[model samples]
Target: MELAIVGLGRMGGNMVKRLLRDGHRVVAYNRSPEPVREAEAAGAIGAYSLEEVVERLSSPRVVWLMVPAGEPTEQMVERFAALLGSGDILIDGGNSYWKDSVRRAEWLRERGIQFL
Candidate 1:
């Protein structure tokens, strides 16, 4: 599947590498840009922003977010919700509380996006 990965920290970076090795088309984004470039060097596409990442893929896009919880996750999800349309999937792989996840999922659903 086509994948867009936001927040290229250790987990996100390694996931990009593994996905590429497994023959998946991966578009990687990072706040710092360095890791995005690194992932690009490793055969993944580099996306500087969420919009760019979404634009680079087809419908029913799957984006994995690997940022910290609280403000960062909230901000990212809000921004991403604007960029994503119906049927798109957003995966938060952070250490967020279950309640936050439930809330986020409902929020995304209200905006016609899917959360996992």
Candidate 2:
């Protein structure tokens, strides 16, 4: 499947590599340009910004967000909701509180985006 991974930390970075090795097309983004370039070098498509990440993939886009829980996750989900269209999937792979996850899912649903 075509995937967009947001966050270039250990989990996200390793996931991109594993997915690419398994023949999936991956569009990877990170706060730092260095890791983006590194993922590009590792055969993953690197996106400099969230907009770029969305543009690189076809809908319905599947984005895996591996950021920390709480504020960062909320902020990224908000940003992604704005960037992604209806039917796009946002997978928050962080260890977020269940209530917050439920809230985030509801928020995304109101915007026509799907969260997991």
Candidate 3:
């Protein structure tokens, strides 16, 4: 599957690498340019912005977030929700509280975006 991963920290970056190894198309983005450049060198497409990430993916886009918990994750989800269309999926791989995750899932679901 084609996926866009935001926040190229250790976990996220490794996810991109593993996905590439499995022959999946990955678009990687980071707040810092270095991680993104590194991911690009490792065969992942580099996206500088959330809009670019969305633009790079095909329909029924899948975007994974690896940002920090609480405010950071919330902000990223909100930003991606605005960019992604109905039928798109957002996966959060951070250490967010379960309640927050539930809330986010419901919110995204209401907007026609799947959350996991």
Candidate 4:
């Protein structure tokens, strides 16, 4: 499977490594360049921005976001909404409140994107 992961923090970074170990193609991104470089060293394709991450994926792009809940996640979702097209998938693997996740799911669905 091919996917893009945004945020290279502890859990996210490990997930990237595990996915690569399992033979998945991973496009990894981080706000700071260090973690992205680290993920690159670990055999994942490093992307500098969310747009570049999207560009690296095929149709129906799958994105796993591992940032913190509140504002950061929301902003990330917003950016995905702008860059991604219909049929794309956005997976929020963060600590977002259930209600917030629910709301985001509905919103993305209305825009023709799948949110998990």
Candidate 5:
């Protein structure tokens, strides 16, 4: 599967590496450019911005978030919801509150984006 990962923290960076090792095409982005460079060196496509990340993927794009919970995750979700089209998938890989996850899922669903 081809996907874009919006956070390149330790866990996110590792996920990108593992996904790439598994033959998945990963588009990597980070708040800081260093991690993106590291991911790029590991054979993942590096994205400097959310727009670049979205543009790098094909239709029915899949975006996974490994950002901090609460505000950061919320911000990224909203941003991606705008960048991604219907039929796209948004995955939250962080340790978020269950209720927040449910709310996010419903909110994204209403916008025709699948949330997980």
Candidate 6:
């Protein structure tokens, strides 16, 4: 499957590497350019921002967030919600409370975006 992974910290970067190793197409992005470049060297398509990430994917894009929880995750969700159309998927791999996750899931679901 093709997907974009935002936030190329330790977990996120490893995820991209593993996915690439498994023959999955991965688009990787980070706040800093270094990790994105590193992931690109590892066979990921490096994207610097959410806009670029969205542009690189085909329809029904899937974006995974491996950043820290709270504001960063929330901001990413909101940004993607604004830019993505129906049928896109967002996977949150951060440490978040169940209640917040539930709230976010419903909010995205209402907009026809799947949350995981």
lDDT of 6 by residue, 91-110 (tens): 99999888999999999999
Put down candidate 3 lDDT per residue, 37-97, tens digits, no spaces: 9999999999998889999999999999999999999999999889988999999999999
Judge candidate 1 at residue 56 and give its lDDT. Answer: 90
Clashing pairs in 6: none
lDDT of 1 by residue, 68-110 (tens): 9988998999999999999999999898899999999999999
lDDT, candidate 2, equals 0.94
List the candidate 3 regions with Cα displacement exceeding 4 Å: none
The 10-residue segment with the lowest total lDDT in model 2: 78-87
> lDDT score of model 1?
0.91
Segments of candidate 6 deviating more than 4 angstroms: none
Candidate 4 local lDDT, residue 13: 96
What is the overall TM-score of model 1 with all chains considered together? Answer: 0.97
Judge candidate 4 against the unseen true structure and give its global Cα lDDT, from 0 to 1.
Answer: 0.95
RMSD of each: 0.8, 0.6, 0.7, 0.6, 0.7, 0.7
- Give TM per candidate: 0.97, 0.98, 0.97, 0.98, 0.97, 0.97
Model 4, runs deviating above 4 Å? none
Stretches of model 5 off by over 4 angstroms after superposition? none
Error of 3 at 41 (Å): 0.6
CA lDDT of every candidate: 0.91, 0.94, 0.94, 0.95, 0.94, 0.93
Clashing pairs in 4: none
